[model samples]
Structures are given as C-alpha cells and as structure tokens.
Target: MTQSATWDYIRGSDKDGYAIAIATNNTVYESREVDPATALGLTFRHAFSLSDNLLLRSSLSAVHDQTWSRRSDALIWRERLDYDIGPLRLFTSVDTKVTTLNERNIFALGSFLPYPESFVTLSVLPGVLYRLSFGEIGVSLTASRTMFRFETDYLGLRRNNDRVQPNLFASATFWGIKVEGSLSYARVTFPAGDFDNLQRLLYTAKATIPLELFRLPIEKLTLELSSGRTLEDTTLPFSVINVSTLSDARLVAKFNPSHALTVFARRKDDEYVGLGARAVTTSLGAEYAYTFDGGLTAIVAGSWRYTQETGNIPVSSLNLQLGLSKRIDFSRTTTADASRATPAAPTTTR
Candidate 1:
C-alpha cells in the first residue's frame, strides 16, 4: 500500500514569481499485485517575467520510497526559459533527477503503474509554439535530448551505460478541435555492441462538437472522437502496448442539473490492433459533484471496467472512490496585482 501527500506554496512578484512545495510517500511491500498507496511531498515553482517577451521557471523536489519497483530515494530539479514574439513563442528547458520508465508496464506506462524506487535522469529540450486567432489555428514543435539513468540495474542494462536519444516532435490545432502529432527517434549505445534504428512516431486527432447537434438540456455535451498510431522500428503500428498508447475512442457527456449539482458520464474503448493481436479492455464510468456559491466543492467518482486477458488473468475490476475536499484561498496572488506594489525606493545615503 502506498499513499502520497504534496503541498505547494506560491508567491509571485512583478518581475519574478516563486513557489515552494514538498512531498513524500510510503509503499508497504511495494508489490505490483495490488496498490493501496500513501505518501507526502511538496514542490516549489518560480517564474520570472523579465519582460513581456521573456519568461523563466525553476523548481525542485525531494522524496523517499517514491519509486515503484526500486527501493531508494529521489530528488528532482527543473528549469525552463521561454520568450514570445508576435504569435510565436520559443521555449527550452533543462531537467535532472527524475524517473520516467524502463518500458516494463506496456499499458499506459502508469495510468496506474507502481512507482519503481526513485531514480533520476538529466534531459534538455528546446521547442517553439505558435498560435493565431485569425481562425482557430495553432502550431507547436519541441525537440529534446533525453539521457536516461538507473540507480540500479534496469532493463538488463547496467547503471553507467546510459542511453541517449534526441526527440523531435510537432503538432497543430484546428478550429476549436485539436489535431496534434509527435515523432521521437532514439540512438541506443550499449557497452556490448550497437543497436541501429530505434525510432517512434505518434499522431493524434480529436474534434469536439457542440451540444446544439444533440439538443440536450445541459451546459455542455461534447462529442469527442480521437485516433492515434505509433510506428517504430520493431513494434508494429498500433500493435504492441508500448507502441499503442491512447489508442481508443471516447465520448463525454456533462450536465449541470442545477446551480449546485453537476453530473458527467463517459465511455471508452481500445482501437483494434490487428487481426490476431490482443485488444485492450473497455470502461464506463460516471461522476456526481456538488458545489456551493462559496469556493468549496465536493465530488464523488466511480468506474466499472471489463478486462480481456490472454490466459488465466483476472477478467475485470469494479473500482469506486469517494472524496471530500474544501478549498480556501489563503493568498489570492496575481501578476498584475503583485506588480502594482511599489518597489522599494533607492536608499539615499548622506
């Protein structure tokens, strides 16, 4: 069983902004069979708008027993800078002491995968983004160098022999809908020999239609359908679990019955992989929420899923959760408001 907790303290100034957070968690037995989770951690984020066109961000974190498979400690630090010109923006970042994954859990990486003990990797990315309101149109591209590491032996590879990869990606949005895509290619250099041609390409397109088509008495009922494919050197397009992430179609229906009541429902299914390949399961779920005029709100959510296994695997599970939360904004901080505060007058000495 593992549970985690996190708290964030954010403060911003006219020229710069800052946030501090801490988090930690504990995993009893740290088993892959079933997960009852608990942990606590905090993070601090800071952004500086040196000018209207220039911005910078930095953050750091520390945790214990946080990784899923490994037994260890972890720390992370990240920094990014961005600048905007006209309708285009350029961004780049450097990050270290973070754990992604080692290609074990094929499903959704960790839509629910356990934390392998805390591990860290150093990476750098530089990208550009553009958005034009002439008609709903947006474009984005990001390239990054990923250097993965392991505190212990991972994926049959030792710790010192880190893999290096250069990732390239681009995406765009159309109208109020989104049609974005990405491509990532890697070069794997092992101490043994060299593996050639390690690459992946991903594409996704989603469109949402207004409720005027269905004539439902609700705030919004969006008709959403999306499809994607990942092409790789070894993994066939949309066949392997690792290759076929987010390979599904989904529909969302939301209704605000009254000023204080809201409800939502959704259904999703996996796209067909191939003629003989195994297919992922499907799920249907619903949620109800109540909110008062105040800032407080309560939500209860649950889901029922059907699973299809290859052998004597568990067929499915009925999962449900109920949570209650109350929110109070101790400090309603803003950029403009904080900026308005008078800067300290230059001290004049006699």
Candidate 2:
C-alpha cells in the first residue's frame, strides 16, 4: 500500500491549468487464467493559501471497473486545514473512502484476494493535529480514534474495537533537504482471548530535492529516496518476535517538454527483509505513461517478483501489460487512487 505521509503540505492554488487524466492496467501471468482489468480517471484542483497561515481544501472522486466488478464502485472524499497560530497551529481533516481492487482482487500489498467471509474492516478517522516549528526545528502530533471492526476468515462472527491513539512525529530541514519520521503506538483490547491485542511499530525516513527548490519550472520533478521497516506481533510458530523490513527505491519525474505530450515515470523496488539465512526476497517495477494533447493516454509497464524460502527454494512471477484510455471529461472519475494527489486534490491512485 502507498503511505499517507506523501502529500501533507500541498494546499491547492487557483489557476486555469489544473486538469488531469490517467489510466492503468494490471496483468498477472502464472500459467493460469488470472483476471485482467484497466482503470481510467480524471481530476481538477485549485488552491487558496489563506494568508500563509490558514488553509482549506476539498476533493471528490468515483471509480468503476470491469475487473472484479462485484467488489463495488469506489467513492472517496476528503478535506484538510492548517492554520499557523504562532510557533504552532492546529490542523484537522475529514475523509471518506473505500477499497479498490488490484489484479487478484486484493486491496493491498500483502495478499492477492479479498478478505474472506466474516473478515471485515470499516471505519472513519477524524483527527486533531498540532505543529511546532522554529528555524531548523519542526514537530507534529495527531490524536485520532478509529472505530474499527474485525472477524475471522474461517468463522462467521464479527467483532469491533474503539480506541484512541496519538501519532507523534519530529523532523528537521537543512540545506534544501528535509528529514522526517513518525511513531505510533496502538492498543486494542478485545475481552475475548483470541480477539485480544497486538502492537505495530514502524519507522520511516525520506530525503528529496525539489527541482523547484533549485529553481526549475517542473514542480512535479523531485528526486526522492526513502526506506522503512515494521515490527509486529509474530504469527509464526515458535518465533520470539516477528519483524519484516521493506526497503523501497522510488523516482517520480514529470516531463512536459511540450504542450502535446505529458510524460511521467514511476519506479519502485521493495523486498521482504525478514531476518533469516534466506530471507532477502525482492520485487522491482516501473511504468511509463504518455498523454496526448487530445486527452487520449496510453501506458506500458511490467514487473518481476521472486521469493526464496527457508530452504532456498525460489519462485517468481513475471508480468507485463499495456493499456489505452479515452477521457470524456464529462464522465465522473473515481477518486480512490486520487490519493496519489494530496487528499485535497484528486489525482492518480495506487
């Protein structure tokens, strides 16, 4: 899954040149009849700086598909605010969202199928935020309560949990480069033995150089490099603690060499860096997009992923897909993937 920290600072600005369109495809090759599908989307956004101290934003989107169409059409909405009171100002947001599907009908990175019967999760998190900054120092805090539900994949019973937790973060920016990270501690008490508790801890670090920071017209062309790891309750039998590390390398560059073509590329590499003799599995992927002046767009992309077992047995999946799209601009576009844009603006999604 894509992380939520990427677009926290992008408050929209008003202008005429703010329309966008996108399309995507997924094809899995495993010597079997895997379902294939494509997605198309569009977006428009404008920003108001509100005197450099207060900001407000909103966006809406809809998603429909022929692949796993049974899942449901996705609808998403969001809003955010940032007001500078002095050294610190309070921030807040409201959001509505639904899961979209990948090739195997799965919604995230860890699996390839929908959650089994009786296994479910649904909730909305409204949060309050505080920011602190001075010279080279910066810090932020968000307290949110999640009203969530869960169930077993094999059983037919549902369970729910209501909890509040604080998300703490600290960062520093220097020499046109900024380093940031955050920590979260969650406690879920279920009364029932098997439904009881778990802990998830994560750490992330990112470094980027904005082309504009160095005075370039391409605002989307930024050099970004980052990595993160997670520790969680172990489900492995006889293991003391369960830890998995995913290291990523990503580069997002936007090229508008002329008004006729909008060129972009996204490359990512991640692997299971679990601790063991043969635990270094990896996957690498890249997508190249070309958007014509007439609003027709095409894409060609591919990926390869390999896994090595404890005994060093290796298995892999190789894939390639091509897609075509025609945006009516009149048809409503789903906002699910629009998270690729700031929550305040609709853009391409995961």
The parts of candidate 1 lying over 4 Å away from their true place are: 1-35, 38-41, 61-74, 100-119, 134-156, 159-197, 204-207, 224-244, 247-254, 257-281, 308-312, 325-350
For residue 45, model 1's alpha carbon misses the true position, in angstroms, by 1.9
lDDT (Cα atoms) of all candidates against the true structure: 0.46, 0.44
Q: State candidate 2's TM-score.
A: 0.53
- Candidate 2: segments with Cα more than 4 A from true spot: 1-23, 28-32, 37-56, 61-79, 96-157, 170-173, 191-193, 209-223, 228-245, 251-281, 285-299, 308-314, 321-350
> What is the per-residue lDDT of model 2 for residues 1-350, given as tens digits with 9 covering 90 to 100?
11110111222233111333333434444445544443434333433466667776555556554342223345556666667676665666665655333222223333333442221223344434444452223333333222223433223322333333345565666677666766656444444433434455656666765556555555466566666655322112122123455555556566552211122222222221223322455667765566666554555556666766555467776656454544443222357645353222222333
Steric clashes per prediction: 34, 7
Clashes of 1: 34
